[model samples]
Target: MNTTSHTVAVLGAGTMGSGIACVMARAGHRTLLFDVDETNLGRGLDTVRGFFDNGVRKGKIDAAQADSAVANLSGTTDLGDLAPADVVVEAIFEDLDLKKETFGRLDGIVSERTLFHTNTSTLSVTGIASGSRLPGRVVGTHYCNPAPLMKLVEVADGRHTEGWAHDATLEFLDTLGKTSVVTKDRPGFIVNRFLIPWENSCIDALESGVGTKESIDAAVRGALGHPMGPFRLLDIVGMDIHKQVAMRLYEQLREPRFFPPPMVERMVAAGDLGRKTGRGFYEYDDNRLFGS
Candidate 1:
């Protein structure tokens, strides 16, 4: 893995944002995690620290390595603090207008050469790029959930995205030891296009009494060669997020398979929002945002 340090800023202090920041810092980059809310920012920072500390406890990284990664991470409430960033990754809310407005506002802050990467899962890259004056520099980088653990990153170029920006984005992901898969700027990119429907099917199977949640998860892990079953993955992703992403794709594609199963509504309503809420398909001792 490349250890050369670079200045990277991740917008939004949510689980995804903090996870990506942890990945960047672990790769020796100076990562600035930004959020408008001070409380959220603090919590996000704590999440990142928890990830590094867990690595030490698990023996995945030594104490010195963990300390170095933690030292490379910082939190900021001010967007102006991101001025020195070589790359600014926008992982804020999934709202298109909010994503657009963010890149537009960053135009005045960062250098023209800085890459603007939008982590929009359902929105069009072209639509988000329309907000920025430097549309050529705008690229779509959809990181799988739990960014620190996921090795694959989907790289999609907007209609106006320049070849230089696309190349640079791929290179940046490489530095972080991430596998970059070039994908179309379409909704869900590569992973979600298949994952959402498959997850829905799994839910349907469980709901229809074809198998219990444990049996279904075990079947997937044992036969399909997945690290975790649909239920376990959903637990990490949060049931609310699955519903939102699934519904967004369904609404856009007009596909019945993209619709989340009815059980999703019940789980979300019950506040069983996966690990973040201490329960989803299973229970957790603590409400950590991601798995160790």
Candidate 2:
């Protein structure tokens, strides 16, 4: 594992962005969480700090370690501020053009050897890499939600990705205590291909009166050995996001299993999106967005 500290920049200040920044900081990297919106940037910084502070609260880490990790993280609005970053991980909106444009702009700001990682759950890595002059450095790094807690990360090399960049990305991820799973640069990669359909089926079970969400969740945890049940996971993922991802996959692969059930549409339309909205398959006391 690499012991040398590196400067890392995470674009976008959403749930995924904050989580990734937290991981980098905890690994002793100088992490800059960037966003164009000042309010989002501030919120993201707070979220990153919260992860460390909460770790100390739960005794997952010592106070000094939490404090040190927080100290290593910063927030920025200026893109040029990331010039010194050795690796840039983007967790922005799921817009192909915007993703491409960000990479294109970043290519000129950062070093030629800097790795460009896109945490895109949908969309093509090859398509995103097209925007970069250094396409060889662009790789798809789809981090699981709650990036700090999730051990698995799906890595996909674009058509033009260089072996050096791919190897370096794996090394960097290892330093952050992540397990990298190499996959083809296809839509949904590996996790979503299985996750979306399974989630939809779980929702189906609830709709068909098979069992209450709680009972079903419990059964899955006991039988399938999953950390959390589908409903609970969907609540964390947000109903709207799940619906969007499901619909997109269905449209692309024409798979019936990828289709979101009617309950998803109803919940989304009613603004019961998830933890961010304080409700989904379940309710939360607070409206704060969870990791991813």
| Lowest-sum lDDT 10-residue window in model 1 | 1-10
Candidate 2 lDDT score relative to the true structure = 0.89
Model 1 stretches astray by more than 4 angstroms: 1-3
| 1-292: candidate 1 lDDT, tens digit per residue | 1236789999998878988999999999999999998987887898889898888999888999999999999999999999999999998989988988989999999999999999888999999999999999999999998899889999999999999999889889989999999999998999999999999999999999999999999999999999888898999888988999999999999999999999999999999998878889998885467765
Taken over the whole model, the C-alpha lDDT of each candidate is: 0.91, 0.89
For candidate 2, lDDT tens digit of each residue in 6-32? 999999987789889989999999999
